[model samples]
Target: MLADFDDACGKIGLQLNLTKTMFMRNGWVPDAPFSLNGTNISECSSHVYVGREVNMMNDLAPELGRRKRAAWGAYKSIEDVVKKTKNIRLRAHLFNTMVLPALTYASETWTLRKQDENAVIVIERSIERVMLGMTRLTQVRAGIRSSTLRQQSKIRDAAVYAKSSKIRWAGHVMRLNDHRWTRAVSDWTPRNVKRTTGRPSIRWSDFFTKSFKERCDALRVSRTDRTHWTTLARERDKWKNCWRPLGLPDDQRESRSRSRSSWALVPPRKQEAGVNLSFGVQSSNKRSFLHFLSNIKTVSVESIFETAFTV
Candidate 1:
């Protein structure tokens, strides 16, 4: 394969940079050595291509964090202008134009799981909080309502934005000719490859299949009719509004709140594991400590010590 590549490149008057060349394994396969011009090629788990990270596991957390930081830098540059502007609509427009692209750059290629979706949402909400010039604690203390803030900001959900982008990219890819490399790969299925024992890792095509089935049930009809697919994919407001029904449920929100609050409490010490710290004790002082701990719902010994020391 290397000899063929060398010949092809030589015919084209192009030379392959052996030092920059590296191989990445896609599945659970043992690493093997490859040599080019007597130079050994290094194996890598992931590689950066066209500013996007490609990896075997397809984890987007690091990429998301990088995008978030870049977006935050963009936000900070115009933050003063945002704060001085009384027009909430203009502030939102600036944010959408300036910061959102950074956050969503190359997002069309991402195969997002629930955790990745949540991470993006958290970043969006945090930025919105900053735009509103209020911290979470201050917002709670001042009796400032969430609905009011959201109405004023007019910031759409990041997840909805990402989903729309991905769907649009898919539509674009679908329109490409079968002769194209991307189109060919998108449609190809490997044959004669030995199967691993466990469940196979989800591929991009698999993710797209599930997403398209759920979101665009009329995909087959749309494929037959280009105009219909274009209308569905190109209409931004319609697709954005489609995500309303997919919002997190009230019970899930409550559970998330409980989980977050749980972080405030310290865990029990190893030495105190066998000790009974229940409220049935006769001493009034210990009863108060137990009651406080129960009410707070935190189980950490560090928090207990901090609370006791503060008191």
Candidate 2:
């Protein structure tokens, strides 16, 4: 392939820069010897192309760390302004507009996992703590701050923002005709190629599919409608709200526990005698059984029995 490329370039009066070029393998394939114009082309585990690092194993830790460092630098540049600003909103605005873009540059292309999300959240929470002038120690001591507090304000999680950006990009790509390279590559699958052993690497499209289902339940009905999909993607506030932390207040937690206990004590609804009941057995031992049932949609008694016994 390199020889053919070199030949084609020569025909067009162009030269291949072997010094600047790198070859990378997509999967767990051993490196093969290759040369371009008698110069050996080095194989690399990863390479930075168009500003984003493309890794053979699809690991984003290095890239994410780089972004975090860049973001910290950006924040440091405006740290004085952030500290002196009387308005919390102004500080937040500055962080969002100036620092976040640096942190999340090219995030749309990332295949994020739970660990990646947690890492981004840690950085974000650190920034938020800085803005509020509270360290981890102080925050723990403060305990149960009011909702109006600056720290309590629900800032959009960086991982959620990245996922949303990818969804928006996906919608754009889906709108493109079949002839587009982006569209074609998105749907392409290698023929008769077996994956390397062990766990398969996560793909950006897999994240898209999962996130779309979670955030856009109406996706199937609206996907073909470009305007609808666009509207869904543009609802940044809605997406942000959806991604808010699930922590509950102390009072709510206490009430929930009490309610669960009370529900557990309630007599079971009458059922045919001698008909084996899964809940009847579970309720005798597990106080949390009723709590779980409350959250689930109504199911047939027989199906519930089958499920419990199968488990």
Candidate 3:
């Protein structure tokens, strides 16, 4: 593919910038250097692309550190304004628009772990405390709650904002076109990968799954929907069919059709291309896909009444 790309670029009167081009090898790359048109391309341990840092190690600490540095820098720059300002609204605006944005840059893309969330929460609270003239000693001495500090400052918690952003991004990804690379990459599992003996990496999609129980456990609290969480966990094993990938098929008809992906924003109501569409939606000349942001809908009072009467 590299050779073909080189050839195609040459035909189009363009040449590769050997010095500028660099490749990141994930793990155990070969001794032979990868090249384009006999010119060896540089390999890098890390590179900042369009602001975000990409590391060969896949460790998120560096990116989080970068965000921290940026946030602190932004905060320090406006510290005088925060300290001296009589206008509470102005201080809040600056914090939200400038300082918070720096802190949570591209946070929607972050596959955050519990530690990462805690880190963000701490940073935000620390900054808020500084603005409110509350030192660590004072915060502890007064026995002030985080909720009280947020109420005093009139600023939302940064960690909560980040989680909200991430969940919203997840929904957007769910509604993405099947052909979109974002959707494809979300579902793609690496083939022939060796399993290390430890806890599996957290998946972004786990927000929609039974893993919410684990999250609540980590938070050391239970939501109002505790029973609902338990139900999902119990039903996972109960409801699943014997559709193991390694097992022999019951019959050809029983096998899931692969002509279309099982995921969709809206399930098809009619047949298409001689196959059951299932949850797959095809191309349409109707309303704009972007016009409607998410498929999640709330039942109105009228709808509840209508359904109740119909029932």
Candidate 4:
């Protein structure tokens, strides 16, 4: 196991030259390729190896604290190393092609689950409708007061043709304001309607509310002063321009490019175990390498938790 240490050190740019420093000369060469003699080796019993490893672990405790404080700086250092060591274009392709597809697959699985839940809700709604068919229905009608009935009729008429563009209910109501029938006519004009050359319409309910009248008095700005859809459209265009540097293509280009590529989306392949790919066998080991590290971590954490919360 010790014979491989020098190669590992070389891989991480920690190679030591014996003549360069006194530490190396004092038989503490940190990057010696191998130890043939007992010069850098301990000839003690089994306890010596455990003691040295414990000391190494103790040294790592301060390193762990330092790493926690400077995590972002460490991340930038790692990114720099990766950029220096790998092909940038290949990395981009792997991220966009492979990693993106895996992420999309996971997302689509969640979406599919949501769709299934919605389908179940629809089924439940249909069952409820079927259950409602078992109940008996009875119709009822009564005579309405003259003035209230007239107002209700006008409201019903306005609601019936609400979507009609040709019907100018606002103009009709304004012309009939001098007539007695105008008292029964509800404010048929839209509440938030904009008029080019006329006074803006007010809510009929607001006439009965003191607080709403006070609020209207305070708000002196006209409807034209408020931001509208045109403002939002300009902001949307600004955002679209901001994303232009990501090399996204127009819809036409995207369609044409996708047609040329033979990419496909399929359900992820999940094997129980021992499924051999061209790369390697899928060993059915219950524990991962991370599990071993986690076990060691849990022991340290348990010690801390025990000390802190002892009854």
Candidate 5:
């Protein structure tokens, strides 16, 4: 036990003290005064002693001052680095904990297999959005680019990936264990097989693939819905006439999408390229991929969602 204790302490550079000291001795009252008189006055006399209550207090100021100075110097050295920091969320995600490990399992077992490309795309786009907003906000708030927002977004993306990964893993376990859920989908089960009670189930593909696709599709749908809201709100006059034929109320379209306390401001949507009859070129009519890519970190095609979509 002693050896193990010392070894553990050594790993974190902890110190041990076993020296005999005045404080450890009996009758060493730390804050009390002492008095002394001539020993010859009386053999039965109890002498009152007077001296410094605590000499260590006087002696330790210099040591304390040195420690304070060292700490301040160390803190100031990282002042510039801290000032340039952005994502607060990423820091929490990188820390080791039970929740983080679960997320890791989920990402590896499920989310990674199917929607790895989409995850990369979402992360890249999210970074660009944050950076663009931060750049403008920083210019106004601090009168300079005091922090690199792109760097922070990467941290946030990494954290999100960790969390999403774990969710995918957990979901895989839940799906396998649920008897009714698995049995409901016969196609998912193999042919020429008979089921026994409490039989173990195996997922053929990576668990993350389906989970990743679901998450990506949901995000895409949300973006599309918001885009439609923006179009309707902006072109209210055109919407009144055009959308009325499709049974959408002209007067309630704007109010239906918003509330008194909440106003819906649309974010820029990523565009996929397809041939347009109105234009001679095969180009995206919405946001340009390169323009958005420049704001984020990497420019890999796999990281961007501008791939050709087929029906």
Candidate 6:
């Protein structure tokens, strides 16, 4: 790995700071020690790269905290304007464009479990409660619903927004040239690794298949071709929503009904092991080798997800 990196750096007229660039790995695999250019590079438990924290265990708590703090900063930066503005639409728009983006930055790649999703939901609702000028105490006393508050402010659901972003990115990845690492990594299956009995670790791909359960199954079955997918589908007027088996996957639809807690979303049903969706999806085993190459993996995160809005 080091040799290949050194060669690439040499070609690009770049030199890696061996002392500063240490080794970091996700928890999915055992750690492997290494020397760079025959010099040993010290190992570390965790490191922050391009703003997101990566750790040996790939745990998301610290990253969530970082995003939460960033989101708070975004809100506080415009607090006066948002709180003072009488136009609810503008306040909601500001939150969606600024605060939500901070909270969900790089969210498409997140592999969150139910508790994590609930935690994110709580964070969003906390901000939303403030947006509506409703304190936690007042909300509890009045039995106010989260949906009611969001409806007034036109706020989007955090979980739904993140998941739909993933869906969109999946579409973009599906249409990529086969030679691309992002495409190769998405399609790569780990032949050496075997599943241990009992439970399995989560993958980013699970974020899509496990989201809507049977509705997703039906979606893949109906739209077996990539061209029919909302992201890949070019015929917006014809086959755009056609891939959505039940109008919009329930998770993607903004919540409009009264729910005491915004976090009361349905738990994602576990996919039966080895039962792959019919969307021609493959196992994603990117972590084993791709983390070291993430800087050059895709065209750009913004380009991938932003184009989905066009479809």
Q: Which predicted model would earn the best TM-score?
A: 6
Pairs that collide in candidate 1 are 266-299, 266-300, 267-300, 267-301
Each candidate: RMSD: 22.4, 18.5, 18.8, 35.4, 27.5, 9.7
Give the total clashing residue pairs for model 1.
4
Query: Residue 260 in model 2: shift from native, Å?
Result: 25
Task: Summing lDDT over every window of 10 consecutive residues in candidate 4, give the lowest-scoring window.
Answer: 157-166
List candidate 6 segments past 4 Å from native: 7-13, 26-32, 211-213, 216-239, 242-311
After TM-score superposition, the amount by which residue 24's alpha carbon in candidate 2 deviates from its true location, in angstroms, is 1.1
Over all chains combined, what TM-score does candidate 1 have? 0.63
Per residue, candidate 6 scores C-alpha lDDT tens digits across 1-311 of: 45665777789899878788666444353455667667887777767755567654557788899999999999999899998899866777788889988998767567778888888989999998887888989988999876567667676677766765555556656565645556666656666555568866566666445444444454563445323232432332222232332211121234422322321112124322222212333334332122223322223323322222212
lDDT (Cα, 0-100) at 187 in candidate 4: 30
Model 1 Cα lDDT, one tens digit per residue, 1-311: 66566778799899877788766554444456667777887777766654555554567777887889988998998899999999766787788888888887776667677788888878887898899888989888989876456555775556756655555555555555535433444555556566678986545445445544544443343554333333443344332323222321122123222221100111122122222211111222322232232123112333433343333
Question: Could you give candidate 4's per-residue lDDT for residues 76-181 as a string of tens digits?
Answer: 3344433454443343333333322222211110111233334322332222222222211211133333223222111111111111110122122223334322
Off by over 4 Å in 2: 1-15, 28-30, 144-154, 196-199, 211-311
Number of backbone collisions per candidate: 4, 0, 0, 0, 18, 1
Better of 1 and 4 by lDDT: 1
Clashing pairs in 4: none
Segments in model 4 whose C-alpha atoms lie over 4 Å from true places = 1-38, 42-60, 75-311
Judged by whole-model lDDT over C-alpha atoms, candidate 3 comes out at 0.55
lDDT (0-100) at residue 116 of candidate 2?
86
lDDT of 5: 0.29
Colliding pairs, model 2: none
TM-score against truth, every candidate: 0.63, 0.63, 0.62, 0.13, 0.20, 0.69
- lDDT (C-alpha, whole model) for all candidates: 0.56, 0.53, 0.55, 0.25, 0.29, 0.59
Candidate order by decreasing lDDT: 6, 1, 3, 2, 5, 4
Model 6: what TM-score?
Answer: 0.69
lDDT for each residue of candidate 2 in 1-311, tens digit (9 for 90 to 100): 45665677789899878887666554334446657667887777766654566554667788788888888988899999988877655666787777877787776567777798778867867777876677877877878442334334334446545654555455555554645434544556656566668986666667535544543443343555323333443344332223222221121123322211100101123222232111111112121221122122223333332332222
Candidate 4, residue 302: CA error in Å? 29
Cα deviation of 257 in candidate 6 (Å)?
8.3
